[model samples]
Target: MTGTTLTTADLDPHRRRILFRAWHRGIREMDLILGQFADTELKTLEGEELAEFERVLGEDDNDLFKWVSGEKPLPEHLKTPLFERILAFRPEEAFKPVV
Candidate 1:
């Protein structure tokens, strides 16, 4: 998917906003990473997981990029299941060589 294919029609205002932010980070790499993750997981995330996701979205895109790309060690504060899920999420299109 070029970006989020998931509809936000069922999401609450907060979740909808988060989904939008995920697909529109300053950098395209981050946008794909988090946006795809949100598309797959945001609807099921609940309570603290959802809150943690929101907190992660607020982090700097460059830092998030480094962490997700494994270019930098993830800090203790950022160690969470949601972060791990993000690190593991890979949009097939995002990693393909552009022809």
Candidate 2:
């Protein structure tokens, strides 16, 4: 199977939880942002990267959205290469929607 193809059950509990959290954020916009990132990138993250991702997930959704969208500067703790990677993510360029 392709790297992008994964069921939540196929992942370990930690990764599965992150994926679910990503897809179920209260705001639709944050859902799309983190959900796409989790789908395409979560399986590839290293231990430290996963830690960073989890920290990000623990944040308040609105603040996370603002940081990712550059409406507010990322706090020092949230400033990591992985966070930058997430901030830079763009699902529009990554996938072609069914028309």
Candidate 3:
């Protein structure tokens, strides 16, 4: 009772499908974003830069969702807009549902 809630079953079929699609899209986007980083950019990162990137990637999926949805404030050092831009990429328009 003290832990996180499990509410996946509460979601309607269409909404659940949308959530699944978004989650998959987000994962793919993260990969592409990381790929865009040059060796120099990654190598040049030190101290806080490296730590922030590590922390962001280390977060669990639920926390990651909260962070992306703006429901939770990202750690100050890890709040780089660059990472957000990378993770927000939409490679496949087919996955994008009409709103």
Candidate 4:
């Protein structure tokens, strides 16, 4: 057989469903972040900055939990610049978070 390129629609039904669910979850997560940062607009960060913001936010389990839980304030390093970066991120420009 000749080489064939497979697109998302070419996936098996089960795989397609899984991908759809994953995409949905990602969108939901982005929505949650936006809601949490209601005062900020999301049209500022570029792709690379958003990637860095995600990386910093995801650094440690405790860090992620603390940021999400509001139990601990985000550190100045992460909060001042990184959080702003995240708040200004557009989901269309975000790459999927690495598992």
User: Can you give the TM-score per candidate against the true fold?
Assistant: 0.89, 0.80, 0.37, 0.33
Preferred candidate (TM-score higher): 1 or 3: 1
Task: Note the Cα lDDT for every prediction shown.
Answer: 0.85, 0.77, 0.45, 0.43
Considering every candidate listed, which one attains the maximal TM-score?
1
Question: Residue 80: error of model 1 in Å?
Answer: 1.1
Task: Give the alpha carbon lDDT tens digit for every residue of 1-99 in model 3.
Answer: 211122447655643443333334345433323333321134444576655555555556565645655578876755586456534642343235457
Off by over 4 Å in 1: 96-99
Candidate 1: lDDT of 70?
77
Q: Give candidate 2's TM-score.
A: 0.80
Q: Which model scores highest in lDDT?
A: 1
Candidate ranking (TM-score, best to worst): 1, 2, 3, 4
The sequence of per-residue lDDT tens digits that candidate 1 reaches over residues 1-99 is 446889878999999998998888988877888888898999999999998998998999999878777789999989987787787786666666656
Model 4, range 1-97, lDDT digits (tens) per residue? 1111223454556434433332332234543443233223322444765455445433564454456445687776666665655545534423356
Error of 4 at 59 (Å): 1.0
Worst ten in a row by lDDT for model 4: 1-10
lDDT of 2 by residue, 5-74 (tens): 4587679988888888877776666777788888989989978889888878888988987777678988
